[model samples]
Target: MQRNFEHRKVALGTCGRAYNTPCIHEHSCLRCSLLRPDPQQRGRLTEVRDHLLARIDEAHREGWLGEVDGLRISLAGAEHKLAQLGELTTRTATVHLGLPHFSHLVGRTVR
Candidate 1:
């Protein structure tokens, strides 16, 4: 069966109604079978990344090597997604803001 799903309320951090897969894991979206993240989720993604970092730190401090390893993997994924989305938003935003593509050219002497 081909299952297709688009995330709905990311703020709630649950599978969207469109989700049809049976896979579920902690921070469901992290390991969801139908994980399809949208650019609009940048903010939430950042929050997730920060939380994962904290968890990784805590695990290491408590000598939980196994847990720390898992959290690091998830954290790397979140950071990767954030970078992808950040680049996309920056490109589109530059056009919308009527700014130069070369950031170094911004806010300089215009004589």
Candidate 2:
């Protein structure tokens, strides 16, 4: 039915790589290709993790993070903190690298 087809489509989109279509032939389909993680993204995530861990360590050394429960909460929040830091780092890097800000570039007429 239509509902089944729609569900299949959504599942395919979520599960597969954007440009990679499932093989139609049996032989090709048998040899399934694995999607590779983006190296830059992996590197960025590792960098973020290390930086956050170091900050947490520094905070603990300075008595900023108190008790085991507080440490657990801080560890749990590290991913969210890293995501926020990543966004800010990306924005700052983009600006520092001389790329015009999206807002500044928008609606400007070129002479």
In angstroms, the error of model 1 at 1 is 20
| TM-score versus the correct structure, for each prediction | 0.54, 0.28
Clashing pairs in 1: none
Query: Candidate 2 on 2-63: residue-level lDDT in tens?
Result: 55433223211211333445544322211223222232344554564566567777777877
lDDT of each: 0.67, 0.44
Error of 1 at 78 (Å): 0.6
lDDT by residue (tens digit), candidate 1, 6-57: 3444542435444544445655566443344678787888898889988988
Q: Itemize residue pairs with steric clashes in candidate 2.
A: none
- Score residue 65 of candidate 2 by CA lDDT: 50
